[model samples]
Target: MNCKEALPLIHEYLDGDLHGSEAKELKEHLIACPACRTLFKQLEQTEAMVRSLPPVRVPDTLTAQIMSGLPPMKKSRTWTDWIRKHPAVSVAVVFAAVMFGSYMSMWNDDKNLMVKGNDLQEVIIQGDTVIVPQGHTVNGDLVVQRGKLEVEGDVTGNVTVIDGSVNLASTAHISGQVTKVDEAIGWIWYKLGEIVNMIGS
Candidate 1:
């Protein structure tokens, strides 16, 4: 198996999810390719390090604090109910929100943008730098333009870098593709395609 074919399967192989024949083929390729083998080893070590980290402890009054900060819930009919009933529409709404949030964040003046917390459903973008802090979980894509992306958290979507670099810290956990393009023209095309996808969804 080629590097391209084996790369995506590495995670599955590590999880013991790959079939026997596929695993054997990947193992053979890893033995023959130094680059792939090194990448596999790094990923394995990162996973081990993450597993060794201590768990975070939440405050006992966190629930009460959250409840106190929020407005009282109402029984009135709302768009939220409709959205819950239509999962497809809900997904589309989330996509639109992510796209919009990402686009807006790109315009901010901050050089270092950070995304932290759990159950986040927004795409993140930064013109200078984007940091996904450790222990955070993001449910959407991340885009970095003319800068860098530092991911030390969990990402449920893709990571795209344009004319920049990506650093996946030891604690980072990504469930989707990671893409980096150095060309300005290619980045423009990619942005256009992403916008089209957001609108189409």
Candidate 2:
């Protein structure tokens, strides 16, 4: 057994969820590995300290004070119970609502420049231009909306520029395709493509 596997089992053991062979294997790993043994001791001490603390009970007056503005009501089930029973459906509905809100705000004839990407740590933002500086590395896909993209360094994924210009320097290194979208329809398609990719992933 390795420390990687034993680490999780240590938590399981602390939670009293581990048993039999899995627990035995973790014990052996802990005994063989000095680092794992030290970590296990620390976690064990933390757990013991936590268990030693007394349970907390919230005051009823505090709850009433927080709920003072709300009208008194009887316990009701309907939508709340339905949501509880169908959590997946509720989650999908909420996600769709939030996405719709974001879409409306983003594409409602606004001229504000926006940039979206999973990795923008290496990107430098100027007034109207986004620059990937030389010698810096952008680790993932980059999207520049209503602005300019000046690429001089390494980009590990796709680069998309919308309603803007992209200037690639001689030393720029891009591992994926680069696309420029100009028209409103093209922007819509780009957004749809992003949504599809997000869902697929």
Candidate 3:
């Protein structure tokens, strides 16, 4: 198969969704295609890094709020009446869902907090390095005054940074260029020290 046809199948191959013969065909194609091999490796690494982070437990209160807002109903009521009776209830439920979703969307690491695709207004890369993982498409520009950056996803807008280095991942597709400045020196120093300690250990 040609590269274009084989490209979409790569995901299936990695997911083990292919039949034996199909799998063999794709494997053979990958061996001959350098670009596809590199892409496969990058995707594998991204998945591994994302999985390594501990799962964030949704707060009990938040979960309770969500469940409570959802409020189970009796089977007797009609759909229209249920919606009419719970007009406020429905709105509350939707709001709660948004809150829960937003909380879960953000990724917090020791060095920097990477926010996944969300309705984030602006991002300021202060002290530590912030990484936008692959497959996370941001709606707006990433504003970093100072800190390291790794963008693996597509940003719909421009990237502005003051004094930090942007290390774009091979799979990254940025729609805008990066801008830098030199305001947050203390944070940078602290971040550098932490990075050094981590490397040494």
| Count of steric clashes across candidates, in order | 0, 0, 5
Per-residue lDDT of 1-201 in model 1, one digit per residue for the tens? 898888767767755579878988999999999988877775564344324322222222432342365444332323233333333343344445445652212222233333232233223333455667787777666666667778888888787777778999999999988888789788788879879987999
Ranking by TM-score: 2, 1, 3
lDDT of each: 0.58, 0.65, 0.54
Estimate, for each residue in 1-201, the C-alpha lDDT of model 3 and write its tens digit.
777777556656645577787788888888999876766664444334334434333334444554474676554443234433454443343345356652213323343344333333223233366666677776655655335777777787666554667778899887866555456775586467549967998
The list of candidate 2 runs beyond 4 A from truth reads 1-111
- List the pairs of residues colliding in candidate 1: none
**Candidate 1: stretches off by over 4 Å:** 1-104, 109-127, 195-201
lDDT of 2 by residue, 131-181 (tens): 899998887777888888999999988999989999999999999999999
Score residue 67 of candidate 3 by CA lDDT: 47
Alpha-carbon runs more than 4 Å astray in model 3: 55-106, 109-185, 188-201
